[model samples]
Target: MTTTIRNGIMIAAMALALGACASKGAPTSQFDFGPLPAAAPASASSIGAIIVADVTGPAALDTERMHYRLLYSDARQSRPYAYNQWTSTPSQLLTQRIKASLAQAGVKVLSTTDAAASTTVLRMEVEDFAQNFDSATASSGVVRLRASVFRMHRLVDQKTFSRSVPAPSADAAGGARALADASDAVAADLLGWLAALPPSKE
Candidate 1:
């Protein structure tokens, strides 16, 4: 009877230890931003009389793409385990989306490379592109964008936009989905803003 009691105590202690270890292994409830989505399709807008130069931005050396780095307001590691997971290189993805939106609005866009062409130049500077977490729920992803438009070396307009969108609830897919959703929101906001701007004249 004494031997049976001793064995029971030993088994209970081992089970407690194992349970503690499992709890420790779980990932902390921290926010993890993921990569942006592939660029969307261009607009059918007549690319009117306006010619937009190729968008420019800070180099994303990590990805060799122009639009890279999910700029954080504070100094925090972007993701815990994944490097470059949330970074998006600025490419035709954003430009195409903007183009498509403008096309829909019947705005003309010109090419930036053609300096000799007599057309109003539209230059866009993407200041901040990132996904933000809600203070109440860190897991809930929100999209934020800050950008400005320039015409003829003058700042025509600037704005900051944000939106709350559904993110993946599962751990396996959460980060990626957050990134894509954020990008989509940014693109949509940018297009809407551009559509509202007064047409530039040479």
Candidate 2:
């Protein structure tokens, strides 16, 4: 009977130690871009359909971590948060937002799996996506993307969009909010740019 009791106590103590270790190494918080606004109604001149290619970025922006820069320390240097991360890769999130925004605006957005005749295609490359800290208390979310419009495999137009939104705080949460706001602005501009182009011919 005494042996049995001693073994049970040891088992319980081991369990508690394991639980404490798990709690200490809990999973980090993850985030997404948040809700997107409803797309504006499609204009009569909107193209019939267009393909949105997956956005690509550098190794840093291509990751799921929330990245930031201490401009005061090194304007050209950046670092990622260890405990805060994005639910999806930054490029992936940006691509989803772009497609959703275009569709909401009444544009016919197509995926790579869709089959269609020669159609206009939009290619985007993310050059920069990070929070920049001018001071310990001040920061800004900066986003830069290069957009190219193609019609029936022919390049029609290309432009680069760069935006900086002031962050409410110098943290990941604030960066996320600022980035979301900048994304909306970029989407609106993309809508207008695509709408002005002539429809593609198969």
Clashes of 2: 0
Off by over 4 Å in 2: 1-27, 40-44, 115-118
Q: Which window of ten consecutive residues has the lowest lDDT sum in model 1?
A: 64-73
TM-score of 2: 0.82
User: 171-191 in candidate 1: lDDT tens per residue?
Assistant: 324534654566567666676
* Residue-wise C-alpha lDDT for candidate 2, range 19-85, written one tens digit per residue: 3234555678888889887665657255678888999889876778787777755678666676778
The number of clashing residue pairs in each candidate reads 16, 0
The local lDDT score (0 to 100) that residue 65 gets in candidate 2 is 78
List TM-scores for all candidates, in order. 0.51, 0.82
lDDT per model vs. reference: 0.48, 0.78
